[model samples]
Target: MLVRLVYASRASRELSPQDLQDILRRSRDHNPAEGITGLLWYNDGVFIQVLEGGRDPVNARYKRIVMDNRHDAPILLTYQEISERRYAGWSMGQVNLHRLNPGLLLKYGETQKLDPYRMSGAMLTALFDELVSSGAIECA
Candidate 1:
């Protein structure tokens, strides 16, 4: 069985692309070891991420994320068990909203901006799925 956990958090300080890249690098290195896959979307100092894996590893990772000093005020948006992984093989996919075409986000009920905090967990996930399907976001 697979479990998916989604959360949104505010960066503790100004974030640079290098910081995000480092995070993704570490994640890509460690997640595959634990059989985890997910997507990370960053926009305007906010982070929305999903982690999918075994219940134990995913929960442990989420706990670590909540305590990570890079970001704070983590809010749980969704957590559920699924029959299969939606992001298999992608240890960590990234969506940098800062550079994405605004038109892509507008297709998901978002305005010209990518403010995911205002979206419900369901809506947010739906948007993520759409982005993935559209090939607007890619994992390294």
Candidate 2:
């Protein structure tokens, strides 16, 4: 069965631009073969991502993510069987928070900041859907 998993984590330490690139590179290289597709959003020290694929592959990937030393306090935000992939076009698209409108953020969130911890998984999902529609996602 197909599943969609969303999670948020904090960086263990200050991440350099190269560090972020490495992560995306690895995901792009590795996900397609596993039938995975998703989007990654990073801002400040926080990371919020969506992974969609078969149950086993998605679960395995999340397990590895939880064990990765670069992340701290990883929190599973949402996981459920899905009828279709919302981000099938991207192996791992990236949300460009820099280009995001603050008004859009405020529409779903309490503040202009993107804080996954403070928002419900449904809220984040809706925001992501809007982002996709708005062409705010940068291709991986």
Candidate 3:
């Protein structure tokens, strides 16, 4: 069975641009073989990501993420069986939230900033769909 898992976590330490790129690079290299695909968003020292794949792989990946020292307080936002992949075109895609319009953020969130901790899984998933439609996601 296929599953989609969404989670949010705060970086354990301050991260630089290179640090983010490294994470993306490693994911891109590692996910395809595992049949994983997802979108990742990072801003204000927090990360919001969606992982889609077979049940076992997805669950194993989530466990590793939870144990990774780079992340602190990782919270599982959503997990469910899915009929299809919403983001299958990329092994791992990145969203630059800094460039998004404030009005867009306010539409789904209480403020002009994205606080995945405060948003519902459904809302965050909707926002991610909008991001894909708006061409805000970058892929290797």
Instruction: Give the TM-scores of the predictions, in the order they appear.
Output: 0.90, 0.97, 0.97
lDDT of 3: 0.93
Model 1 stretches with alpha carbons more than 4 Å out: 96-101, 107-110
Q: In candidate 1, what are the lDDT values of residues 1-140, reduced to their tens digit?
A: 68988899999998888988899999999999999999998878889998999999999999898889988888998899999988885899998454466776686655876666676777778878877886766776
Q: Write the per-residue lDDT of candidate 2 for residues 1-140, one digit (tens) a residue.
A: 99999999999999998999999999999999999999999889999999999999999999999999989999999999999999999999999877688888999998888889998888899999999998899885
Model 3, range 57-80, lDDT digits (tens) per residue?
999999999999999999999999
Ranking of predictions according to TM-score: 2, 3, 1
**Cα RMSD to the true fold for all candidates:** 1.8, 0.8, 0.9
TM-score of 1: 0.90
- What's the CA error at residue 101 for candidate 3, in Å? 2.3
What is residue 15's positional error in candidate 1, in angstroms?
1.5
Residue-level error in angstroms, candidate 1, position 134: 1.0
- Give the total clashing residue pairs for model 3: 0
The lowest-lDDT stretch of 10 consecutive residues in candidate 1 is 96-105
